[model samples]
Target: MLTRRRFLLALVGQTILGWAKNLFAQTGVFLTEQEAPEAVFPEATAFERQVIKATPELREKMQALMGKFKPSIWEDAYTTFLAKKGGEFLGYAVIVEEIGKHRPITFVVGIQPDHKVHDVAIMVFREPYGGQVKERIFLKQYRGKSVTESFLPFQSVRSVAGATLSIHALARGIKKAAALVQAVYQEGKEGGW
Candidate 1:
């Protein structure tokens, strides 16, 4: 026979275990390499990974071009996946992680070869709220934005009603990612940097 106290304790323990399971299950890939290509370039048949190392010279160039230091989420090196169809370049997909209100949001920014943004997708939104940033309507605003453009929340980019922090974080991240692509791929091709 189980006492009422024992039953209550058991229920609490089960609830804790359930939350623990959810936390552990979320540890896998947020923006997978396989999915980014498909999302950014659905018609593409092949993709290539372009790795850019964050050397001091490269960092200085990026800072100068962006007018600020690189976002902290970026590492010493990062990858930009280029999508192609039969050798015809489609665009590039770059994943950038930014700190949301209380958690990190991992997103993929697709940039065309012309330096304009193609699309934006939230691969993983860890916060309890602010998942609204993933909506198509919100993400569409990023299309065609470039490193030369400014993404001001509530001005150029519409801010989510309750997810202002997330909106700002994503807008900043997108700008940084676009600048990185421009500095490495576009400028390199043009000036042979």
Candidate 2:
């Protein structure tokens, strides 16, 4: 009942399906949007979304903080969260992304009012080999890091062997997040939330 032509057609269909499945598997979502904010600010009872635009001045400031390498994934607008507990301001959380090898890796970075990193969480990872950057051991290094601190891998932040590019990407994203929050939430800034 099985002819050669039919068998070849079935084989091709299965191969195509397998390739699609493998491509899907390379992208992983570790946390949802709701969970990311909660994970970064566990004690906060409420979160307020704040949309901030990238003005020319703000972009210059970010560039100064980031040095030579600019974040390629930055957009004209950004959405950050203000976490509060009992009506008291807790901190700010911002989602940022940077290219990891071939794909973008997204992260949620929490910054305290004092401009220090409180916590960090990975929302999505689009690369297959660099998922190790999402591990707690790698993420904990960013805690307490201020915008003035250095994120150089192997110097301040440790590196994962196979995830070197990912480590660099995360370091850039964290620094950019901290800088953005500090610039936007500064006492005399136009849009201080």
Candidate 3:
């Protein structure tokens, strides 16, 4: 009887553990690659996709602009969308990823022609909690921010109560995005550097 009871208890514990794992492993895909640009550039009538490679020199410039070296932000290549309205260039949008707690959070950062942040949208949120980071109140803080601006928490950027990690990840990701756009499309460079 003792052995039978122990087996039953073990089985129950294993079952509970499995359920908890599944609960936390859920992935939420709020937007797709195509839809993200439309959401970020609502008024734009046209969007041209461009694939930019990350060369050694470009990476070095990005590092200098970002003021830190984060490998996760520097992929082999980046897919960007150039938005236009009636033949007028509006801005660029780039998709970036950063770690939130344990999993990666995908964000679509829209940058204006002047290099300021136009908007930020989350494409995929893998963490179980901290979905509140997607809320407008948290993301709106990024608008109008430039590569020269500070993304530090509680100053230029606001932090969520339980989503501190996610917020920090987003701040870093946005700063990286701004720096990328600056390096690729600096003022008066013409056709980018």
Q: Write the per-residue lDDT of candidate 3 for residues 90-188, one digit (tens) a residue.
A: 899988888888888998999887768899999999998777888777788888887466666687887677788888788778877777888887735
Residues 115-150, candidate 2: write the lDDT tens digits.
778999889998867677788887888888875666
- TM-score, every prediction: 0.76, 0.79, 0.80
* Model 1 lDDT per residue over 1-193, tens place: 9999999999999999998786555434455656876776778898898878878787676667666534656557766788889969988888777887777788888878777778888888887666678778888888877645666676778877767878877876777677778777778476321
Better of 2 and 3 by TM-score: 3
Off by more than 4 A, model 1:
1-31, 68-70, 188-193
Clashes (backbone N, CA, C under 3 Å), per candidate, total 0, 0, 0
Error of 1 at 56 (Å): 3.0
Candidate 3 global lDDT: 0.81
Stronger candidate by TM-score (1 vs 3) = 3
The alpha-carbon deviation from the true structure for residue 82 of candidate 2, after best TM-score superposition, in angstroms, is 0.5
